[model samples]
Target: MENTMVFEEPMTAEKCSGHLSSVEDAIYVIGGKWKLKIIIALHENGNIRFNELQRIVAGISARVLSNELKDLELNGFVKRVVHAEQMPVVVEYISTDYSRTLKPVIMALSEWGRKHKKNIREDLF
Candidate 1:
């Protein structure tokens, strides 16, 4: 049997309100069009340079990537490291341990996305 995390208890009224607030807070932090994608890329690639991240994310302009990375760093989900040893200097972005807390959420979303795509494909055909 596969081990899966589950919430066994039903949410109480207070718990429901707290959960909703927490979800709203989370959405506010990572709510932008590019924030979660940027986080996922950093999580997958580990430490990545700015240019590389832009390439990996695709369709994001340098300005937008810069803005999003700053937001992620500000939100404590990502860290920006600068290496001065390189000739031209280098900057890299890495996911924080705090960001790892979202792994399960990301995985669940990925699983749902796969199923959604399959359902759409089936419906179309």
Candidate 2:
């Protein structure tokens, strides 16, 4: 099989290294188990309330979902808004283009998973 990425020798850092704060923050926002699925839900549907997002991604606890949404909002991947409705109000989650930017990453992961599944299935039979 052909390799997709070129490998290079390891690097050594100087006494001081550039801050990886933003990069680390981005990874932290999207690196969790359920964050990507949450983004996918928002991307597919323009906006959704808290309960709606919880429904969209089943098997996720309320606390976990809340944390993921907070992380997404902090990282600029999602925007949280208050609904202009009646007495009872709701908080909605919407994906920003920044979240949509994850399309290629998600697509690549899906393609890789599909290939792995196919190979495994073939091997089984």
Candidate number achieving the greatest TM-score relative to the actual structure: 1
Q: Each candidate's lDDT (Cα)?
A: 0.91, 0.84
Deviation in Å, model 2, residue 55 alpha carbon: 1.0
| Model 2: per-residue Cα lDDT at residue 39 | 92
Residue-level lDDT tens digits of model 2 in 79-107: 99887685587778899988888999899
Per-residue lDDT of candidate 1, residues 1-125 (tens digit): 24664667976899879989999998999887899899999989999999999999999999999999888889899999999999899998999999999999989988989988998999999
Q: What clash pairs does model 2 have?
A: none
**In terms of TM-score, how similar is model 2 to the real structure?**
0.78
Which ranges in model 2 have alpha carbons more than 4 Å from their true place?
7-26
